[model samples]
Target: MTSDDVRHRREAGHFVRWALAQKIARDLSFPAVRWNGPSQAMDDEARWATARRLLHDDTLKSEDR
Candidate 1:
């Protein structure tokens, strides 16, 4: 790949890592606020957990292909 391609790929990877970190930070702090109600909060927590699992799980990655 060209230099631009490599730089773009690196930037994408950095963004993904940063986004994941932000999600984790939010997830950890979510329990402190109940503005959306407990049920909605629970749903949001579950969604984040599932997303994190799918992103990190090797078995799921293999199955996807």
Candidate 2:
């Protein structure tokens, strides 16, 4: 693989890890907050699922990039 490819992969991994950590922190900090109609619990579940999927996939995409 090219250097750029490796770098991108590394960055993607970092982003996924960061996202997973954030979800975990939020999950641990407090019960799902209900704001308006949507709840934090639903958001957390989606984030967790996305993070898991990204980690399993060979190629990672980061929105921050």
Candidate 3:
């Protein structure tokens, strides 16, 4: 694989990890104004499901920035 491919993968991984953290933070309602809409509990498997789907989806690649 090329270096660019490796870099892209790394970026994607970072994105997934960041997303999971954000979800956890939000679920905890740390901030006073965060959306409290029918919040779902975040588990390892659920987070992994998000990452798995994200890694396979290129449609959102350009939206990260």
Candidate 4:
């Protein structure tokens, strides 16, 4: 593989890890807010699922910023 390919892969990996951390932070909901809404739990789950799927998707590797 070319160096650009490797660099892209590494950047994608970094973004994936950052997304994972964000997922955790969102899931925790440390400061319980009144506007969280009834769908907060589902939203958090969906966010994590989407992040996980994108992180592992070969198609998304090229698309990650």
Compose the digit string of candidate 4's lDDT tens values, residues 1-65: 23544545545555556766878434322222245456545577887987788878786656571
lDDT of each: 0.56, 0.55, 0.58, 0.57
| Residue lDDT tens for model 1, 1-65 | 23544545545555556766878434222112124545544577888997888888887756762
Q: For residues 14-56, could you state the per-residue lDDT of candidate 2 as single tens digits? A: 5556766878434322223234854545677887887787777
Model 2 clash count equals: 0
In candidate 4, list every pair of residues with a backbone clash: none
> How large is the C-alpha RMSD of every model relative to the true structure?
14.2, 15.5, 15.1, 15.1
Expressed as tens digits, the lDDT of each residue in 45-64 for candidate 3 is 98898788787767776565
Best by TM-score: 3
lDDT of 3: 0.58
As for lDDT, the candidate ahead, 2 or 3, is 3
Ranking of models by TM-score: 3, 1, 4, 2
TM-score of 2: 0.26
Candidate 2 lDDT: 0.55
- Lowest-scoring 10 consecutive residues by lDDT in candidate 1? 25-34
TM-score of each: 0.30, 0.26, 0.32, 0.29
